[model samples]
Structures are given as structure tokens and as C-alpha cells.
Target: MRELLVLLLLLPGPAVAEEAPPAERRTELLYLLRQDCGSCHGMTLAGGLGPALLPEALSDRTVEGLAEVIRAGIPGTPMPPWGFEITGEEARWLARKLKEGIPP
Candidate 1:
């Protein structure tokens, strides 16, 4: 019963959907991912000033948690909130991609 409740909570509701950001912005976002984010995360996302963003490194992180970090930024760290530049939906999208490995 407890496990069923947890599973249900994790399931996406029919009325709640998280769509990807506009296609037009993908180019820009990808650039940010490489240049801005890469500045710390590493050009190859192999960990430099910041921790790695590779799928293997992010295997334990939750999409929602990553989205929160993207939106709110980490305190006492170099990471800053990009919420103004990127929407919540877009942040979520990025989190998913980071977990799956961003394509070149």
C-alpha cells in the first residue's frame, strides 16, 4: 500500500504536462549549455570548476531537483539563477537532457 502510494505520487497526472521549450530557442539554449554552463561544468561536462553533468554523474539526481537548482541556483556557489533567462519548462527540459547526455 505504501509503495503503491509512492508510485502514484511519482506518476504524471493526465492534466499536468511538461512540454519542451520552443524549437526556436533550442539553438540558444544549447549555446548556453556549452558556453555559460560549460564554463564551470566543463566544455565536455567532465567536471571542472563545477561537478560533472554527465549522465553517469547525474544518475542519482532527480529531474525536479535539477530543475529547482536551475531555477533557484545554488547558494554560496558560482551557480546563479537563470530563471529570468529560462522558463521553468525549459529548465526541466535541460535537466532531462543532462541526464540523457546532451548531443553535439
Candidate 2:
């Protein structure tokens, strides 16, 4: 009974925090990932101090390739790996959002 009460109380926080739509959530995550990860990869993902991430530029690459980039940034560049900042799943999610392009 006590355990059930705790679970009930805790569920709302997680649920409320997930208010964004799946795509929106992914977009926000991508923005954050870009900001955190892009600190080195260029704020616009256009390869400033780092490599570019333009969709047309990466159109030929597989999502896995993109995920790898997110997981482990390009070597010999200012970009450092982010394998630990977020999980593979999160990386993939970001990749999908990038592929979709930031919605209007």
C-alpha cells in the first residue's frame, strides 16, 4: 500500500516533465545536444570549428553514422566524445531529429 502510494506520487513528475510531443521532445533534446555538443561542432551545426552536419551534406550517411558522430565526435577536432553524456538511444533520437530538420 505504501509502495503504491509512492509510485503514484512519483509518476506525475515524470509524466508532466514529458509534456512535449515526441518530435518536440526530440527537437529540444537535439537543441540541447547541439548546444552542449555543438559548443565545439559549431552552434549552427554548420562546421565552424568542427565538421558540418548539414542534412544535404550527410544525406548519404546512415543514421548509424550520425549516431556515431553524436556518440563520438570527430577526432583531431575540438569536438570531444559524448558517449557518456547521453546513451546510444538518446544519440539516435537526436540523429532522427536532425534528419527531420528543425520544424517551423
Candidate 3:
């Protein structure tokens, strides 16, 4: 019974979904998006030095893919990695928000 329980504990379980960031953190993230990302993606997120971040522009991309880009950034480009400032879960949330189209 002890061995069986140990085996069960060692086995992989179902994937756990990450919870959304708290309201205050979400607000701060949004502000970072507007200020930092906006510097390249455009204040309206339409387009600028970087491509547009609007929903339509992101429609073909997967949330995970976008999140990876957000976390890792494109190398050899002006884009800089943001992994230091945000967690992977937060990156996913931002990716989802971009896909949904942020409200004006």
C-alpha cells in the first residue's frame, strides 16, 4: 500500500490551469502593455515598428505561441524579452486579451 501510494504520487496528474492575475496586477499588466509594448506596437495597438496586436492580426496565431513570443521575444529584432517582468501565466493572459481585442 505504501509503495502503491508512492507510485501514484510520482505519476503525472491532470494539468492544472493557471488562474488569472489579481485585479491590481491585471491593471498593472495592461498599463505595461500600453506603455512598453505600445512604444513599438502602437498606442492603439494598430501597428507601428512592431506589427499590430489587434484581434484580427492575432486570429491565426495560437495563444501559447503568442505567449511564448511575449516571454521570449523575437531575437535579432527590436523586440526585447519580457520574461523578467512577467510570468508565463501572465503572458498567456496578455495573449488572450490581445486575441479578444482590448477595450478602448
Candidate 4:
């Protein structure tokens, strides 16, 4: 009985730890929104060499559209392709996080 109890407790530890880290999601989103994007979109994402991506400006675009842009890259502009650097899934995650909203 004690061995079974110990096994049950041990099983949950790995299961709980396997959960994705919220910090990772936030960090990746911030990096994409700020650093990686700042090169053209401006430091605050308000607007710069690239078009603004703030909620107000991006209201017309859906998360999927944003993912496609990230995956395919905008043509005829300074924004280079990121599909090679980050996977489509990662891009989708970033798009969802950004569109869903995040703290400044």
C-alpha cells in the first residue's frame, strides 16, 4: 500500500512539471513583439518602418492572418522572413498571444 501511494505521488510530479511554462509563452511573445519585431515595426509596436501592430491597428487582421504573415513574411519591405527562424506553430502561438493581448 505504501509503495503504491509513493508511485501515485511520483507519477503526478512529472505530469505537473510537463505542463507548458506560461513564462515561456510570454517571453517568446514579447521577444517577437519587441526585439525581433522592433527592427521594423518600432520598439513599442506603435509603428515605424513597418506598419503598426497594436490592437487598434491590427483589428482588421485575425490571429491566423498574423501567423501566415509571420510564416510567409511580407514582400517588398524591410521585414524579412521569419518562417525559417521560427516554426509555423510557434508563429501561430505568438500571433494568438499578441492578438489575445499582453501587458506592456
Candidate 5:
């Protein structure tokens, strides 16, 4: 029983919310957003081949849903999975930023 208890204690706990990426990484991520994502979403994210990422445009979407889309991408669409390039937490942060409306 004690061994089992110790094993349980040693097991990894459920994921906690991750801290925002470091400022340097944040800068890189934003650059990627503007240069890479922007190529498809529009330089201003005002909707081009991809839909607008403005707060109002994403008002109906949940952060988790947006994160999933960012990581997984939409099948049959031009969007490609970015999971290989960015971490899930980073994606979530980007999703939140998009929902809040990133500055121009």
C-alpha cells in the first residue's frame, strides 16, 4: 500500500496552465504570426484566403477550440498543422491573443 502510494505521488500530475512564453520567444512567435500566418490570414488579419482573426470575428469561438485548430489545422483547407513548429501552450497563448485582437 505504501509503495503504491509513493508510485501515485511520483506520477505526473494533470497538466497545469503554462506560463506565457518568454519575451524573446513571444517576439519570435509574433513575428511568425505576422510573416507566416499573416501570409494566409492577411497582413492585418482582416481576412484574406483565411478568415479574420479579430476579436469580434472570433467572439463565438472558445480558446481551446482555437488552440486545437492552430495545432491541428483544418483538414481539406489550406491551413496546415503547426504542431510541429509550436508547442500546445504556445498555440493556446496565440489563440488568446487573437481573441483579444493583436495590435496592428
Candidate 6:
């Protein structure tokens, strides 16, 4: 899985974002992350069908890059892009939070 991330990082992509979601929206977004992203990334984010999203695992990855991946997804992989459901800004926020190992 780590190897996949390394390969993904080698690919080129776009990036950007705005302010994080508000309290209510934040809760919804967090639920989306847990239920949607968590489906593949694992509820604990340790690893599963998708790569581990834990902070230590994602240490080498930048927030922008991960955000791009979420927005556009890695080509030729099971990881589908979430552009339809999540905005670039939300994706960026998600990436940043994932980097910090997610809130408890």
C-alpha cells in the first residue's frame, strides 16, 4: 500500500482549497470521511482495501498532493475520484486532517 502511495506521488496533478467546513458541515464531512473514505481506508485508517491513512504512513505526502488525489484520484487504481461529492477545498481539508492522524 505504501508502494502505491509512492507511485501515486510520482504522478502529476492540480491542487487548491478554501476554509474548513463549519460545525454542522464539519460533522457531516467527518461522517463522510469515516463512512465513505473509511470503507476502503479502514475505520481506524490503519489500512484495508486502500492504503493506510495514518499520519505516520502519510508523513512523506503533502496535504496538497493528497487533496489532489482525493479530488481527482489515482489513475488505474480502485480509488475513484470524489470530485462529485467533495469540493477541492473539502478534499484539501480532509488531506490535512488525515496527515495529522485525524481527531480522536
The best candidate in terms of TM-score? 3
lDDT to native, each model: 0.78, 0.61, 0.82, 0.64, 0.80, 0.76
Runs off by more than 4 Å, candidate 6: 1-18
Candidate 4: regions farther than 4 A off: 1-26
lDDT of 5 at 47: 84
Ranking by lDDT: 3, 5, 1, 6, 4, 2
Please estimate how well model 3 matches the true structure, expressed as its whole-model Cα lDDT. Answer: 0.82
- Tens digits of per-residue lDDT, candidate 2, 1-104, equal 33433343344332344323354454456557566756765676776666666676677877778889878977987667778765677777566556644322
Ranking the candidates on TM-score from highest down gives 3, 5, 1, 6, 4, 2
Worst 10 residues of 3 by lDDT: 8-17
Which parts of model 5 are misplaced by more than 4 Å?
Answer: 1-18
Best of the two (2, 3) by lDDT: 3
Of candidate 2, the 10-residue stretch with the lowest lDDT total is 12-21
Instruction: Please tell me which model should have the higher TM-score, number 3 or number 4.
Output: 3
Error of 2 at 58 (Å): 1.0
Please write out the lDDT profile of model 6 over residues 1-104, one tens digit for every residue: 43434443343333223467554565567777778888998998888999999999999999889999998988999899999888887887788778865543
Error of 3 at 31 (Å): 0.2
lDDT of 5 by residue, 1-104 (tens): 33433443344433224456765676778778888999999998998899988899999999889999999999999998999989988998888778877657
TM-score list, all predictions: 0.79, 0.62, 0.81, 0.68, 0.81, 0.77
Worst 10 residues of 1 by lDDT: 1-10
* Residue 41 lDDT in candidate 6: 86
**Could you give the C-alpha RMSD of every candidate to the true structure, in order shown?**
11.0, 10.6, 13.2, 11.4, 13.2, 11.0
The better-scoring model by lDDT among 3 and 4 is 3
